[model samples]
Target: MQTLHYLTLSVLIPPLLSFFAEPGALFFEGGATNVGMIMDWREMAGRPTVRGMQGEDRWNAYYGAWSGGKQLGSGWVEGMWDGRTDPMRGWVIAFSWMFASFADIYYLCILVRRPRLLLDFALTLGFSHIVLTTYYSASIPTSLFFWIVMFTWSATTVTIAEQICVKREMTEGLVISPPRDEVDDLEMGELLRRD
Candidate 1:
């Protein structure tokens, strides 16, 4: 049950936060009125069919270089950037991920109150992303950049969470006083010793 809870939160939270961070790209058409960038769900999920195109045609349309002019079929179009093909959207997504990682520290350290499991939770989140991307894309992500980003995010989360948790644990109050009877007995012994 505990494992289930951890897995659920670790796997679900970051992506959900990312989506929320940039909802216009996912929900609004073309991300903006003039952008000509549409969220290609089929391409994102690695399905072969997209707007009556299939196989190589679908792949080319979605992943091919931008040629400009009214070509809504291609994922990369003029004035618009998908994270894969351009740096603008890539940076936006990176920021979103950073925000999510910060939230993870609060969730794991303060809310869940399990500082020791911070590393495990951070690793679980990274591994979950890999598994999810593979499942959705129907193939393992072969990009070196993707792996590097995942590692960086996980390492950062763990580092920050560990520091916060350690600080919290260190400042926690300690109970040094004995029970009432023990204190009375010690007092009486001290009195006798003094006599």
Candidate 2:
């Protein structure tokens, strides 16, 4: 649920804003002005904020670039940073997606899984994807794919949490304890003994 809240609030907003904001691009070329706790304001120009639709950076990326580092467009993960500060936000976003994937798997491993928390995590993921989508419009298909995956994970987690909650309530209802009876008699007995 917390993750869902963040998904609805934090993670989702940036990308939605990026999509509409028109200026905040995701690729290296989409130079930006970031505002956050860790970030103040920056000016990144002539950098590859957005992946250009040309050259081997697109086609020969998978095969040729494996020797040193993965392509910069490798979703900013899988070896995409170039020792620049762009990773401040993109790297965190990429890492978040990675963390969310791990969490989704972890919840699946829970013995008595209540995956509602996964929804929040998935929401975080959705927003991360939204960030990617906002910047790399060309990468829409990939971002959209991940969004679908997040939704699937969310559905599973939410169902699990709901089940757990219902089961917990039922279990609490069935708890056995001494019944409440003869309260007035007990009170009268106590009062007479005190006198």
Candidate 3:
């Protein structure tokens, strides 16, 4: 049931958002701005503030090079630094994602009971969000790394979800079992004999 709820929330919510919000704007660009805490006055302002205006100009020039537009050339680093310093508003967005990820991990821990798989999924998902929220502050290489982590997290999470959903035996109560290795039994016997 927890697994089902997690899947329902994770799988359903994003597509629902896509119906209302502009696609890729929130995903690729710094458009999830309103999704988290509104720390800046500009963010709350109905109209664009100075930083928003400046950030948009900076964003265009930075994204311009990749889009085959004129490059920032020597001014690239300075432009990046300027964008990184503006406001810590991005952290609020990141924190919201982080909290959601944490809740998912907690539910998974109870649902799966498989430590290794759960750990891998949780860590990958956690790091992906961390990288994701840092988009405002990240450079080109770091942004590329974030994409890589996002892909890895997606693949790992899908696999784990599939395993949980398909296995009917794991759908209920604590699925505990003792270690099943003969080597461990032998080691235990040897220790008992020594004592």
Strongest candidate by lDDT: 1
lDDT of 2: 0.41
Which predicted model would earn the best TM-score?
1
lDDT of each: 0.52, 0.41, 0.41
Candidate 1 Cα deviation (angstroms), residue 23: 13
Per residue, candidate 3 scores C-alpha lDDT tens digits across 1-195 of 334433434543444444544443333223343322222222211112222324455454432211124332322354332222222332332333333444564466567657456656566554544454345333222334334434454455555554664463455555665677976898899999999
Q: Indicate whether candidate 2 or candidate 3 has the larger TM-score.
A: 2
Question: Which 10-residue span in candidate 3 carries the lowest summed lDDT?
Answer: 41-50
Sort order, TM-score high to low:
1, 2, 3
lDDT of 3: 0.41
Q: Give per-model TM-scores.
A: 0.52, 0.32, 0.29
State the RMSD for candidate 2: 12.4
Per-residue lDDT over 1-195 for candidate 2, one digit per residue giving the tens place of the 0 to 100 score: 334433433453356435433332333323222222111112111122223345555533333112124343333344553323332444343333444443444444353244345455445655664564445443333334344445654565455555665666577679675555676778789999999
TM-score: model 2 vs. ground truth: 0.32
How do the residues 1-195 of candidate 1 rate in per-residue lDDT, one tens digit apiece? Answer: 234433444454345434543543432223322111211222222233223235655344544222233443344567553423322344444454566676667677876455788888778767776676566545676656555656777888889889988877777756557899999999999999999
Residue 14 CA error for candidate 2 (Å)? 26
